[model samples]
Target: MNSPAFRIRYGFEAPECEPQLESLLAHRSVRRYSDQPVLPSLETTLKAAAQSASTSSNLQMWSAIQIERGEKRDRIADLCAKQRQVQTAPLFFAFLADHYRLASLAPDRAERLEFTEFYTMAVVDAALAAERMVCAAELAGLGICYIGELRSHPEKVREELNLPRGTFGLFGLCLGYPDPSRPADIKPRLPMNSVFFSDVYDADRGIGDYDERLSQFYREQNMGDATWTQRIQDRLGGPDMGPRASQLEDLRRTGFAKK
Candidate 1:
């Protein structure tokens, strides 16, 4: 089949089937913007969609700080390895893994908000909302990029955003109109065999194929040999600790010790 979407993603043919997909397969992240502001209706709907995501045990633990000020964006850009796109984007959102909201609402200091301190749930809840926001933004004709480097200086980010205890900027999202000249594509994922498993878990079964396919995809994407192993080595292999390894103290200050 001459399906542009499948070919663009896989560089091979995929069987076209009957399904009402949202056409979001054309997803791309935009770093440039015109002087025009995002439509207010779209903004309202996007927020509604972000809120609509499922919550953990109905505790609803995530919060997002929508950024509009240029000075604030400039400061964040400075902290995030001076990525100029951080400042250029019309909208930036600091997606907070907000346990503080639930804790603050506790009737008493010793009321024992047993749920807040659990590390695993907090991450899951926050991630779900952030994922929802991304899908919603895409549906709204907006381009978005995830800023994982917000963790580079969590303390600075917290101070800048005035984040209270039990809340941390897990990540940032940049949103705006994508520059047509510089387009983005859906990052490829391994086939179902690698990630999805049946009753019993299995390992070391055809994993090498994924690494090779991903390497080829990365090269074609003009990303310069972005193989999974090379990327992991650069990110994780260090004679000294990298940016993320420096976060032990910051995480403590933000009020969660993995223990």
Candidate 2:
């Protein structure tokens, strides 16, 4: 679909241009980083930015563990499916859905933390915090890639990080300056009509021309021309979730989602 058609169909209007909005709209996952180092002071500022994100009921049930370069970092990278970004990023953080601190504060009420609601809250808190940090990093000219495979081997992650009972490693973040020689492009997204709905959900508003757009994008990136529908089917149309199949059991062992 053309831009005019999309705007007319979606009742869209052009927003006033702003640097922050432009940066956010231009977001692309950068797997390759340059040799530049992320300064310690900037790291502290990014942590502060993460802490500034809104939390559920002011619970602030999230924490981030910075993984320094060493054997432990290498092991954690291995646990994350040996992703190059995880291995080589100048700054790596394992964001956690953490209820341990709160449980410790109120030992008598610790049982409440085992409920599914608390687990959901913790996960939401962690995600919001991470996104805020990512935004700040992007604005500061750093690139980032998220590693969801952090949960692929949850038990091993816990062992590597020495996580307490009430904490769960949700995901990992890799941050560094983007390598100029290995640029990443902002991938095409589904049209807004397919996602955003009116008062009620509309299931029939299928992805309009997004399959073709994404296929072209893949071809440009030298990736196979796989449609989004096929990718979704390949990812979720099976019973096996690979190493993540045991995630629920691992979460229970870590004192989450018991209910």
Using lDDT, give the best candidate's number: 2
Write down the TM-score of every candidate: 0.86, 0.93
Worst 10 residues of 2 by lDDT: 1-10
Output candidate 1 Cα RMSD.
2.7
Error of 2 at 114 (Å): 0.9
- Write one digit per residue (lDDT tens) for candidate 1, span 146-253: 888888888788889899877878888887766766776666656656777889888765454556777877788777877777787887776776677767667666
* Residue range 1-259, candidate 2, lDDT tens digits: 1243233223344444454466776678999999999888999999999999999999999999999888889999999889888989999999999999999999999999999999999999999999999999998999999999999988889889999999999999999999999988777778877889999999899998888778877887889999989889888888787988888899898889999
Q: Which stretches of candidate 1 lie over 4 Å from their true place?
A: 1-3, 17-19, 33-36, 107-117
* Whole-model lDDT per candidate: 0.72, 0.88
